[model samples]
Target: MFVETEEFAKRLEAMDGLEREAAYEAVVRWFAENSGRITHHMHLAPAHTATTVRLGGGEPIVTDGPFVEGKEVVSGYAEVEVADLDEALKMARSWPACPIVEIRPVA
Candidate 1:
């Protein structure tokens, strides 16, 4: 799922220690609860650490940043084997952190 990186940072910055801890626990709980469906998951590093390689051109051009320049960056991803899109949507709707979740089929 793609997360709004800026919004996530702002939320954490606004939270106190206790609130941050609770938020973290909530995320853990969510994963635990959905572990059955989640076949694989990963939390990516910050956007600044990303490396983009453009192969569309004849020569590959490597860039030292995110794939695009936008307020939202894909902070993490979860690979779930659901029955259908509806089920995937249900899971995305319950995400507690980050304001955006983009559910796409695994090609």
Candidate 2:
């Protein structure tokens, strides 16, 4: 897990109804345009939290927040496939308001 703060989310949330519609449309267009690199995208549930199970037969630890303690919590994720690490890093850096990009290879 990683953490960084970006103001883009707050700005988008502050938009009025019509403005939000326009913004959503633009995002759809952008996603379509970058369909190859974007691959799959979905927003994480806002009420999501983490629960830890202990191996010592002890009580499980639960938190009302992210399981990982870091400067950033993953609000969402994207399954992006790029040419190589360099390309992946470049694409990650290009995100509009991504404060932290956690790139982990799926097993």
Best by lDDT: 1
| Candidate 1 residue pairs that clash | none
Model 1 earns a TM-score of 0.89
Q: How much does each candidate deviate from the true structure in C-alpha RMSD?
A: 1.4, 3.6
How accurate locally is residue 90 in candidate 1, as Cα lDDT from 0 to 100?
92
lDDT, candidate 1, residue 2? 56
Best by TM-score: 1
Q: Estimate the overall C-alpha local distance difference test score of candidate 2.
A: 0.63
Q: Please write out the lDDT profile of model 2 over residues 6-64, one tens digit for every residue.
A: 46556667889998888767656656766788678876654245554444558665456
Q: lDDT tens string, model 1, 3-98?
A: 877867887899999999998898899899999999989999889999999997899999999989888898999999999999999988888888
> Where is the poorest 10-residue window by lDDT in model 1?
2-11
